[model samples]
Target: MNSDPDRQVPFLSYGFRPFFLFAGLYAVLAIAAWTGWLALHDMPGVWITPTFAGPPQQWHAHEMIFGFGMAVVSGFMLTAVPSWTGARRIAGTPLLLLALLWLAGRAAIWFSAFLPPIVVAIADLAHLPVLAVMVLGGLMVRPAPRNLVFFVFLALLTVANVMIHAEWWDFTSDTASPALDAAVLLLALMVAIIGGRVVPAFTRNVLVMRGPSTALPRSFAWLDRVSLASLAILAGLAAAQIEGPPTALVAGVAAAGHLGRLSFWRGMATGGAPILWSLHLAYLFLGLGLAALALAHATGMLAVSAALHLLAIGAIGGMTLAMMTRAALGHTGRPLRVVRPIAGAYALVALAALVRALGVDLLPGHYMAVIYVAGILWVAGFGIFSAVYAPILVGPPLPKNPPSA
Candidate 1:
């Protein structure tokens, strides 16, 4: 552990420690409480009395993307962008303030049903889009060629968020779904973009493992560019769903492009490391989510609602879970060994995603049962991560320069 708090207090220095710590803690408590809200709705002492008026479906949709998913995005962006641009880390007072913004937003959303709807509109929708501004603002001032596009992503996310808020405010129902889709796709794109860069880099650094050698795939940077173009075209079509065959075409291509991007990352040799496998598997959800949607849309029989949870629970939720776990451990200066509980935690989350996806369809009568188990598993997964990592944050960090993976 660094004896000097001053040193670690710098944003990049503490890296994923603080955000990951708080995020994991919040994940367990927040999602569990939310799950409880779904089943046992009359608990008064619960977090601010569930107020957002909807069936559990839409509420869960909003919270998981806006709630659990947003927190992970905050942690990763605050921690990583500074390092990417050689800018000073957003730590001490500013970092803490940003975290408060997140917490306040959560509070506002929790009591949203009770409060006026507009209040929920301003508070819940405001944070991350603003976060996009803050993060990109730093990066834009002193640009890194490799990273500037991410800033575009951060900004586009804000636009999607505004559309989401607009939908909630009774502007239109169609906008919300597309906005939600864009946000998840953007996150997956970020994961694919960033993960492609970091995962193998981290793996090689840790295990001294070489990249897989099966006539290794092309970088396909052009595909990334085209994917963004496809998303933009789809987003426009989404704006007017009734007007365009091009909309369907774009979505189909975008989904396939993401799958190809995943393939190029050379996704093996990850099985040996917990951090590595978790990331690789989470990314697989990205491809799966997109493909599922593409196929769902192509077949007239498929519903849009059925395709979304694939990205929500599986891609977005899983990617966040894997990243928070790995980033927490790595940035904390801890060794890369997995404890048994943590291993079980990983397994539980994967199971949760599967149960939510497959179980819901196959056993309509038992959907709640699947969800209940998923909620339990999700809570347990983060609970374990938080417990193990809490001491690492509140106290001095673990010793620097620990052994490799």
Candidate 2:
């Protein structure tokens, strides 16, 4: 490692460094805990208390979305926003404080049963607003309109989180579901936004490095507008609980638009690289999940929960894993390539998504068995990831620039 006096502590030097590690570990541990709760909640002597004072299902959903999901989002935004807005990277004390706030929230929620409800609410809901402020601070430096758009979404997500806690505190009724649904849709929108930029750009870079010039991914401005607008409309309707054929039709349109949009991204070119292929597969899940969601609401042939899991476990989970691994390697001064074990990790998560999203219905008689298998695979995948990448995330970042591939 370079011994420059300017080099800060490894873990606190960059936002991605610590947050990625935490997210990976949380992904594994949270799922393992959730699985245990699901399997043994009814057992007479099981004392696995998450300290959630609300419905266990609500606790699980909230943790996955605001917990695991936001950590990855924080890591990504803190790293990527600087690149986007030409601002200095957040580091040192500020980053550490931000990370600590996140950890505090997780801990508060875990021990909520013992804490006063107001204290739990304050502790749990504090991270996102602070994150929004950090992000806005960066975006304000140069004020890129495109990048600044996320500030609005982040604020909205904060509201959604608070709304869920509101329901937990009996400040509202049946609001958690809609709030979570909105949060999920917002995350899907994020996948669309970030995935649109990175997938094709990364693919283009890889293809360029491999051979003679290849066709760059196509972009259609009009379709991009339509897709985003339709998604926003769908999210609004869902949050508002405006159930009708009209909302379903809007969702269906959005799904089709997203699917068609993904088709033009040249995902096929990414097949050779696990890093690239994983993202493509994850984006495919986003499209399929939207379609399934539309079908569920429109025709009732599929379960809404099932449809959402494709986005959750498949898209959000898959994409975050792919990004975490790729970013960890690249930022740590390593080759942007996956080894056998990492490749296996990707396959396990994909399998987990399939099992969790579909197998519950396919083998209804063996639902718990399917869930157990999915949980095991989910834990194994993230376990391998956290084990492999922990050192890289904690070590000094690379001094040299990586090759395009």
TM-score: which candidate is best? Answer: 2
**In model 2, which regions exceed 4 Å deviation?**
1-7, 42-50, 210-213, 399-405
What lDDT score goes with residue 213 in model 2? 66
lDDT of each candidate versus the true structure: 0.67, 0.86
Tens digit of per-residue lDDT, candidate 1, span 235-339:
455545532245456677877877777676556755667776777677677667666666666764444555566666666666777777666666666677767
Candidate 1 residue runs with Cα over 4 Å from true position: 1-15, 41-49, 53-56, 171-174, 204-218, 226-248, 300-302, 401-405
Model 2: per-residue lDDT, tens digit, 1-405? 332224669887778988899999999889899888888875677776556688887888898998999999999999888877777788878888899999999998888889988999999898999999989998998887789889998999999988898988999999999999889988988888888888888888877776776776777888888888888887898789876577778878888888888898788888778998999888888888888888888888778888888888888899999999998887678899988788889889988988988898799998888888999999999999998898899877666856686
RMSD of 2: 3.1
What clash pairs does model 1 have?
Answer: 1-399, 51-113, 52-113
